[model samples]
Target: MTSVPTPDPGPGRQSRPAPHDQRSRPVPRPRPPGPADEPFDLLGIGIGPFNLSLAALADGVPGLAAAFYDQRPDFRWHPGLLIDGATLQVPFLADLVTLADPASHWTFLNYLKHRERLFPFYFAERFHVHRAEYDAYCRWVAESLPSTHFGQQADTVRWNAARGLFEVDHTHLDEHGEAEALDRTYARHLVLGIGTEPYVPEPLRPLADAPAVPVVHSAQYTENRERLLAAEHITVIGSGQSGAEVFLDLLRARPAGYERITWLARTPAFAPMEYSKLGLEHFTPDYTRYFHALPEQVRDRLVPQQWQLHKGIDTETITAIHDELYRRTLDGGWPDAVLTPGVSVRTAGRLGSREVELHLEHAEQGTRSRLVTSAVVLATGYRERPLDRLLAPLGPALRTDAAGRPAVDALHRLELDRSVTGRVYVQNAERHTHGVGAPDLGLAAWRSAVILNDLTALLTGEEHYPLPVRTAFTTFGLGGPPPAATGTATRTAALRHG
Candidate 1:
């Protein structure tokens, strides 16, 4: 990890204006309150990876009071796809504290050491461990941060006129499955680290309501994997990483002697992520600068082209699936799994007690076809829907990019015109503004640090802890910005409707 100053945009890329001059629309800074101000210094809306990382970082920072609330009762990463053998797309070093505090007791390496697998894991000589291992590591980190954890669903966030702070309304769901309880938290800063929800295509949404058809998103595969595996025929939709991974997982887990599997996707071809070292730099903080500086349309073009890097499976996984299929072919066996790319599901209707009728359009075939399957698995991916519905009245105040993504700065603060004084930080909701690494572990710690810095800067006169350049280099594990400092234009306007 090497650190550099922000760089100038390359050919065809947009250059950034100086920070102060470009967006001089006075950020509605909240006035600092007296001793009777608030209970917690900050309130984190979601306890997913990003905010989880924030909790870990906050633990070490003195006088920084924080509490994280999650809709789930306990800490669980994507439990549905916690496939037995699936591995993290990135290195295990990207765990919670390794990038931020390598020697910290809560690192994945430390978790392995504490579990007495440190030496064994090293001897295994694997770059990435099973996805289960990463989940366990995250659980360990979450458990250690218990004091700051709140198991409740935040229903809405509104600025309390009297308190002069953000009031978060939460529905508490405790262990043993009880009903909701009234719980509230007031803080000077609110961080919306709410995780993403699984997405299924509109044509398939009705299938979700059909019990007989048994439809589910790829993220929840683990829960339905056994049943889907036992089914005579399985149809998987979407060509992204999750879809591919789920299709491969099912194919590999055939019940001794299963016949065939149908994998359908809308893309023309299954594309591999850019594997070049330089290409990977698009995930670094440096890229965030370059991406933030781009014109809206150019940024839109860049996203779809680079979607595979963030949404698709790694090269190793793709190759593994290909190798397995090839082996079966060499053994005089036709591939049981059929990966149909460039096929769109036109519509789906409930069939008999156990099947779904799907009208599909194949681009190359230039024809329409119907497929009946015992089950449908949607790996179509997800959208970062507006926080407005959840924010209620606050939605009117929140700003957006030209594309309607939550407008944000490099610091992950939602761009708002006026409405509220306290800062609203978003963790997983800034992809359009922040780029591919927006929700990754590499940016988790740094983003949290920046949010905290901004919050403190707004509330108190103290500047956020200046991140040591060494930490940025080590934690990011990618090339940094350029060496020379850049300048921002005065009174420049950029579109940020989302």
Candidate 2:
């Protein structure tokens, strides 16, 4: 397919600076495109931490040609929820390259050293670094890597059978993300790490969509915090880590005696995440291997039961919220905050120009009530970004499971038709098949190592990243051999369509 280049602006009008960052950089473009162009060895769709890990590891390979693209001006991990002093759920070693290759130049410790803060970090002796610092560490790796391209949105992907390659159509955008030109690139292999998006529940969708209503998702908490805090009363919905963080931030910011905030959750009680030593092993590769080899029905039944593994509140965050709320009652009266569990918001609407009315229901009591507040923050969590739109071109070739989701394998490759020889690998999108650890930060580096190992094995008949024989001390199952590298995966892929 031919790509139409952006016409010159005649040298008079300069494009304005892009959003997110003010620093000016060259307008992003892939190398020249035509029949004569050579396909990249690997092309990544998104530049989130998962893909950033892949890019960082790939940079170490002697002559691998790879590029990762994102629509944003630059890498920023959950900018809205980077609440002050909010630490990562996982330890700092769960950084981009540390778990996979600690000696790599892109390790978090190396980033600290480069910034001249290694001694201070050592003195601090911290395990869980702040989320804002984690964001900075990832940004450091992202910005330093030459293979990552910002401001480029991959539009669609279709296989060019004639070339035996995956063809990606992407758009280069101006400052405001207005498309400047359309271009296409070819890849021998494709890796998609386009991360999740903020989710708003059905009951609160209307208020969230209304322009005047102050119903905001926690994903935008930091950005819209001032507007929310200025109101007379605020209600926070959702009981996940995000909900807890938002509620605590608001509680700390509001004045002591008049702190009018309501925190609601559907859980029986505000619970802590599964952080016990044995429970933590669920995020290990051993458990992931066991989870993937389970029967489809069993796998489906297991994910919802494992919510506490990934969706529960941080124990520390929950404790901090309790402490802050308890501290407010020192003068012999409870602070004006209400924390109710086992309740859900049934419906929500704009009560007035600046307020929202939430209809609440208690699950056990079957009781209904209405809470009209000046503002509402939906601390509701995120959902995986659907791949249907991006994979439509290959719909016929792509195989799906009984529930209609993609049939991903233990190696994380889409179970596609044998006609499509090039593998379409996915990251952080296989929770159904792999288990709760699919999106965990601690697993990001391991997953990338697995991918790189397989990718190089297929290309050079040798693995690029050698993985540990085992990662978990606990035995996940009675007996099942863990997934080997691509040697076994190649054979499994061949039999997938048989």
Alpha carbon lDDT of each predicted model: 0.67, 0.81
* Tens digits of per-residue lDDT for model 2, 36-82: 56677788888889988998888777667677778887788999999
Residue 424 of model 1 has an lDDT of 76
What TM-scores do the predictions have? 0.83, 0.91
lDDT tens digits, residue span 120-148, model 1: 99899987778888887776666555333
Per-candidate clashes come to 13, 0
Model 2 spans > 4 angstroms off: 1-35, 480-498
Which candidate gets the maximum TM-score versus the true structure?
2
